[model samples]
Target: MSPSLTFRPPTTDDAALLLAWRRLPEIAAQSFSDVPDDIDRQRAWIERSNARADYVHRIIQVDGVDVGYGSITVTHAEWRIGTIGVYMGDRRGRTGIGALNFAPMLNHCFHTLGLRKLVNQIFDSNPRVLKGQALLGYRHVGVLKDHALKDGTPRDVHLFEMRAADWAAVRHRFGLFRDMDANVTG
Candidate 1:
């Protein structure tokens, strides 16, 4: 059986943890350029996000232990769309727990948050993430060539989106409800 996972709003005390994960090469490589690495900068970013109405940073816990982080950010106001980003810290990444955690997190974004669409940007070079997102029902939108510079090299990024209707159609295909109930009760 998979370890249980849960998410909660991040608190000020979590600033340090977030900073540590953000600095990890595995996590940082997948993110956009201009991501802050300094502890003070990360702390300030957390404070600012906490105060913003359109942003939420959440801590992902597995069996009561902090293992990673995820966030839902309003990306397009006119479309009522949001983007979700998640990373499984080193420990959990090796255990295949990241995908399990995303199930509930995605449901929360679509059902609880009432988001019309969820967008994810995956680096074209990161085929692992692209495959995972496809398995989760995200449709390929388009690629933004030379969209970001990571490690001082321009890289292409593929945009994927899961609309409300698409989610409703494909969610049950994974038996997500059973997993969701188990997660809630286990």
Candidate 2:
């Protein structure tokens, strides 16, 4: 299905919710950077994000209720490539809900923003995300074995990536094909 949730860039008013979401135990465990407890520090992060053209931090809202965060870091503007990251802080459900959130974000990247390739690395500990990524048409490109630490324990990182073409080939199966076609042809 197409997205029913709203995807918008973060604002100063979101500092508190952002702080709390990052502090969620599951989110913190997998994050590459630490989430400081201070609200000012969180706002400082939003400021930094605003300053970078390649960085985007979005607050995911469903019917005006904040539920998660999604971000993409453009590693190569010339190549139309980037990296994706997301985490749900306040909601829990069956595996497929990720599609509801991911389809729109990716549609924005691939069609609206003109990104060609998107890549992301998932901690092996988070198998659920891996499954979601696979279902979304991302392919396993490589792995960094024991390359990162979580609570002093090393965890392997699995890399997944998709080109615009890759997404097109599978979009129909996931209900993301129609909007893309309409945007391109109409």
lDDT per residue (tens digit) for residues 99-151 in model 2: 76777667767876679999898998888888889888899988999989877
User: Can you give the lDDT of residue 107 in candidate 2?
Assistant: 74
On residues 97-144, what C-alpha lDDT tens digit does candidate 1 reach at each position?
A: 746666776676667666789888899877878988888889999999
- Candidate models: Cα lDDT each: 0.76, 0.78
Clashes of 2: 0
- Candidate 2: minimum summed lDDT over ten consecutive residues — where? 177-186
Candidate 2, residue 27: how far the Cα is off, in Å: 0.7
Error of 1 at 4 (Å): 0.9
Cα RMSD of all models vs. native, in order, equals: 3.3, 3.2
Q: Candidate 2 — which residues are off by over 4 angstroms?
A: 1-3, 92-96, 176-186
> Could you estimate the TM-score for every candidate?
0.86, 0.87
